[model samples]
Target: MKDSIGEKQVKVVIMKKFLIFIFTVFGLFVGWIAFMVYSYERSYNEWKSSYTGKIVTNSEKQFSSSSSSTQNYDYKKYSSSSDGNKDDLESLMNMFMKRLFPPTLLDPDYTYAYEKAKSWSKKHLSQQQIIIYLTKYDRYSEDATQYALNKLNVDWKEQALLRAKSYQEFHYSKNKLVEQLINIDKFTQEEADYAIEHVHFDWKENAVKEAESSSNGGNISKERLLKILVEYRKFTQEEAEYAIEHAKIDWLN
Candidate 1:
């Protein structure tokens, strides 16, 4: 009976030691996880601080200075460089953390921002226009919008021509067209000039059309139409004179 009692006490002591060992290991594991989380969060914050808030300029020349550098963060570069042995705890943790929380998630609306930007591009919107609408009206994050802008393959000259063509239905002189293209459409002078050079327009014909329209189907006199064309519509005196001669209007009326 005494031997049985001694064996029972030894078993109880061994069970207590085993329990203590298990608790110690569990506590260390919890501490390690906490430290890893804190490290990841701190690193992420530092990276974010350095990667955001770049400016996008309207000028092509200034693009490198104030542009989508922030949006162009190379995650692949980081991932590839950080690719160490799988047994490396720091490397494994970084990989795991990056996968668990991608940098794009920093802006909750990144998906919406890029998608909307693409839609705007398909509609033949200017880069400036897309940037403004995304950041100003839609309130998308600048980084995401800039990223979307950079991804787009756009021909600004072609866009300028398309925009210029849209003005054909209106009575705009070449000077007026250039002014509208540069000032309103945010196209560069070079682009606007290229557009004007390429677009199919007969300024004299447009002047005649304007003269007739100004006559309001012969409602106004030729002299009044001449004044409207040359003064208001910015047509040259020669063009306006041609328009007055060719347009179907009755000076007697």
Candidate 2:
């Protein structure tokens, strides 16, 4: 009976030792996991602190800047930097982010173009203008950026006025302006007509300006200037006659 009691005590000690061993292994595993998490967070914080809020402009911008009309300006940019460490937790998180949200979903390019469209729209850009700016200059998806443009509530008639102003500043004829709006800028016939009728310009004075501009070569005869005024400029014969008669050019020479 004493021997049995001794064996029982020995078995109890063995079970306690086994339990201690299991608990020790579990504690070590948890500590290791915590340490790794701390290490990754420290690395991420260090990386973030070293680089924050930096801007880089495209030195070789390829877009046209000829039209000098002032517009409300808005722009946005996105960028990320890395040390090329593929095994880091930051890299894993970045991978997860990419999986969770693709470039299309994140759509930094679309956001950039959307903001630009909003700015240009506020400053009187036509829908076509915004569409062109996004697809041609910014190289964004035409459909997507256009969707963004359509989402904005803008004054189309005001845009037409702005378009008219741009052309009229260059002394475009009434018909020429309308033709450009319809054929070039994709405005409807009705919309073009509305813009043309509303824009405040004297077609006769515009004809005179046209005649003067062409007569600078000193080779424009009266008949040729009259043809240019009436046929090419879509002016009435009476208007053309008045323009040629009142033009500041030597048609007699």
Best TM-score goes to which candidate? 1
Off by over 4 Å in 2: 1-106, 217-219
Models 1 onward score TM values of 0.58, 0.53
Candidates' C-alpha lDDT: 0.77, 0.71
Error of 2 at 127 (Å): 1.2
Q: Clashes in each model (backbone N, CA, C under 3 Å)?
A: 0, 0
The candidate 2 region of ten consecutive residues with least summed lDDT is 72-81
**Per-residue accuracy of model 2 over 25-97 as CA lDDT, tens digit each:** 9999999778667766765665555333211123123134433432322112111123323334565565444
Q: Over the stretch 203-238, how does candidate 1's per-residue lDDT look in tens digits?
A: 999998888777766767777888888888889999
Model 1 sits at a Cα RMSD from the real structure of 18.0
- Relative to the true structure, candidate 2 reaches a TM of 0.53
- Output the number of the lDDT-best candidate: 1
